[model samples]
Target: MSAYGFEIVQTLIVDTEPDEYVKRAMSKINAAESNYLAGLVVGLRDSVLAFSMNVPGTTSKDFLGMVLVTQYFVTMKEIGALSESNPVFITHGPGTVKDIASQIRDGLLQVNTTQN
Candidate 1:
């Protein structure tokens, strides 16, 4: 497996009316000189709508820490790119990258169990 580097530079979180915020957020994203931008809109139970935008590159997928490098590290370790002794960034501290990926994946599933 190959390693990739994302040159993300900006992040914007807007909590407001979705209709207005979506338009404004797109405007800003398009106006920016970056080659890539990803956006997500989340609506809560209390009717609170939030819009988040990640700019510049691939790191945008990690919006809420939901999409992280743990999975990639796991794959790398399987292919021998990483060793069991290699430490990786986990929830609070460093841990065995290969060992923690599955745990993190499970935890993320639980956190996102509710869907709209």
Candidate 2:
């Protein structure tokens, strides 16, 4: 992973209340095309975290990040289902797009050193 490079495996747009719109969105993303290591955007009432979990067929090849949108909380079970990578959680204010660009930059640097 280079300093300016990051990969996005999967993306989940969740809602805290799990309403019709949120549910529909989740279903669509889940059914849509995704990468081997999926990234998740978990939303709470006041904050959101861009996260990735460890699942099957994924290894510590590199680190990446993404910005999560929407408003809703996610269950532990749901989080577990989609992630199979090192969990990266960064929380920020609601409705604000906190870019995980820096996180990915730092994380990859760390991974490179540790793996090497």
Candidate 3:
């Protein structure tokens, strides 16, 4: 992966909080559309992150970060959102976005720094 020079990481912040989280997710979705349309109008970049997800009602804060941590069904339903090369993490118990994000961050803290 390091050979790529610069990596394009896509992250999704999963949570179901007061309406604020939902609004932020929607904003990211719209940003994706905008980026896609811009690429079409202009031209695609050599290295692209292309962040995307199936929000159904939930999903990321950073461009190069975790994809999402929604309910199992929602995550499965958006399987297409992930690249074939990317990894998927599943949590069995209940947790908010922060809880799950923190767990993942701590687990991978040595590997990389998490950006929300």
- Clash count list over all predictions: 0, 10, 7
Q: Write the per-residue lDDT of candidate 2 for residues 16-114, one digit (tens) a residue.
A: 577899899988787663532233322331122222243443333322222223221343336657767567564655433334444545787999999
Candidates, ranked, lDDT: 3, 1, 2
Q: Model 1: how far is 24 from its true place, Å?
A: 14
- Model 3 off-target regions past 4 Å? 1-48, 52-61, 64-66, 70-95, 110-116
Superposed Cα RMSD, model 1: 20.7
**Comparison by TM-score, 1 against 3, better one:** 3
Identify the candidate with maximal TM-score: 3
What is candidate 3's CA lDDT for residue 108? 75
Question: Against the true structure, what is each candidate's TM-score?
Answer: 0.23, 0.20, 0.24
Q: Taking the tens digit of each residue's C-alpha lDDT, what string does model 1 give over 1-116?
A: 12566665665865655788889998888767343432222232122212233333434234424334544545555756545555544443345543465667687788889551
Please tell me which model should have the higher lDDT, number 1 or number 2: 1
Off by over 4 Å in 2: 1-99
After aligning candidate 1 to the native by TM-score, how far in Å is the CA of 31 from where it should be? 2.3
The C-alpha lDDT values of all candidates are 0.50, 0.47, 0.58
